[model samples]
Target: GNATMGSGVDKHALERSSYEVLTGAADIRDAITKAEQAGYDLLPANADLTAAEVELLQMPQRERRLREALNSINGRYDYILIDCPPSLNMLTLNALVAAQSVIIPMQCEYYALEGLTALVSTIEDVRDNLNPFLKIEGLLRTMYDPRNRLAGDVTAQLSKHFGDKLYRTVIPRNIRLAEAPSHGQPALVYDKASRGAKAYLALAGEMLRREEMASAGA
Candidate 1:
């Protein structure tokens, strides 16, 4: 079983409980608990982690705090995913340092493309200095509105540069996608037949297939 994670994922308009989860706080070095009936284990995050910036600034190997914390429990999972915040920060740096690869889910917007450029550069810098094995696993098109001409143009630009690194699965803009989180459920669990759910399923399949192909090639 791959024990995947997506860290630093917060909502724009958080419910009271949601706000508490990120700012609710937990010990970083060893606070592992399973979330709900999701079967997957959860790692707690706290608002105080933001203060880790200054608190850890004077500490040695500050960039590796997260990596070290996770290493203690590395034997528990086959895979781990870290969903970082939008901006580059110590927390994000820790995630990149710990990760072997990254899957970037991007909205097809002009601004998003600019974000990608900066993110990619950061990845390269991290790969060269902090984590030599870091790789961009894939770029996913998200919130795709096929009717939008700008979305299409941005995607085409992305494909031109990323080529096979761009995933074939495009997650369309859907109400179900927005609603599932509010109900505290995954789209697949909430509405298995919904377009949002199906797109995500396809994305998972594509990722698995790529993994298989890479393993075979290796």
Candidate 2:
């Protein structure tokens, strides 16, 4: 997660958090924890991270802090997913600079569309000025309800605009998914039979398929 926002539930305790890594107070490796249940290593964040946003402004090469940190552990993982805060800020810029591609997840709503426009513009600005290789990997429609008329309309609009860049798998609104985070577990681990769990599994399959097709074409 980004340094400025906390995920509410604590995952692990660290000698040095993302805040320390960003400020050069600690090594990035010190902040990483192995989350066995979730099946991935995590760089957990906490309340201390809230101060990093303001402190980063005075630091040299501020926007590249995250990228520089990750460079030390390059090729150690298949993917490095940074969960950014809702609003754009210095932390968001660091994430943008660090990432090669962005998977944009949004609810199918009018306000979300407005936010997408701003986000796309921000991505473009970052690509031009900061990270030239940055690109939109795909757009994910989350918490989707097939029965909702507004959702269907917005989905149509997204399909028209994004074409194949919009993912075929839409994450349905499911209670189990919402409750799993509170229990400090993923939906698949909490209830694999749940709609949310199956949807995510399907999404992963779709992503793999696309990757294979891209590789073959290349």
Candidate 3:
């Protein structure tokens, strides 16, 4: 319906809160503290940070702002996730430096494959010069529709290239998943019976199973 949901967050609030913390007007802290869970933790995108990028350019070890902010709150969470803005910007470098592993979510399309090549190259550069701990953990195929032949072709190509690094679970394109965000909720909370919700649940299970296997193998 695209109607306004009463409980949705204000963009200005996120902008204000983020600017205060990021610029040290308030406290320097992990971006996680800025989130409001809509079923999963999400540090809402702060547009003000785009300006911070320029401010960072003149500073020493500028790429380490996010990494340093997060370090103070270490061991608070088993996993810390950052969704990067597209492009190899200063902010993206900060996340790569802070992360232990990278998960690349790709759409089953030729353009997305091309993007992966660029992302892989960037990851390699970060590993070589910035963050040695960073490595590809998984490549998740998103917005998948089996009816599309192009999708199948791209999936096959990804399998051939990535092999074991690609996750088996695919996130299918479903209306419920799309609709959930407008209502300020996760698909599972908005429509637990929906295919999108079920697929996510399956993905969660696969993630846990793989984590256990990795620990055993390690």
Overall lDDT per candidate, in order of appearance:
0.73, 0.87, 0.74
Ranking by lDDT: 2, 3, 1
TM-score of each candidate structure, all chains considered together? 0.84, 0.94, 0.86
* Number of clashing pairs per prediction, in order: 5, 0, 0
What shift in Å separates residue 75 of candidate 1 from its native position after superposition?
A: 3.0
Best of the two (2, 3) by TM-score? 2
- Order by TM-score, highest first: 2, 3, 1
Segments of candidate 3 deviating more than 4 angstroms: 1-9, 14-18, 28-42
Q: Which candidate would rank higher by lDDT, 2 or 3?
A: 2
Best by lDDT: 2
Best candidate according to TM-score: 2
Model 2, runs deviating above 4 Å: 1-12
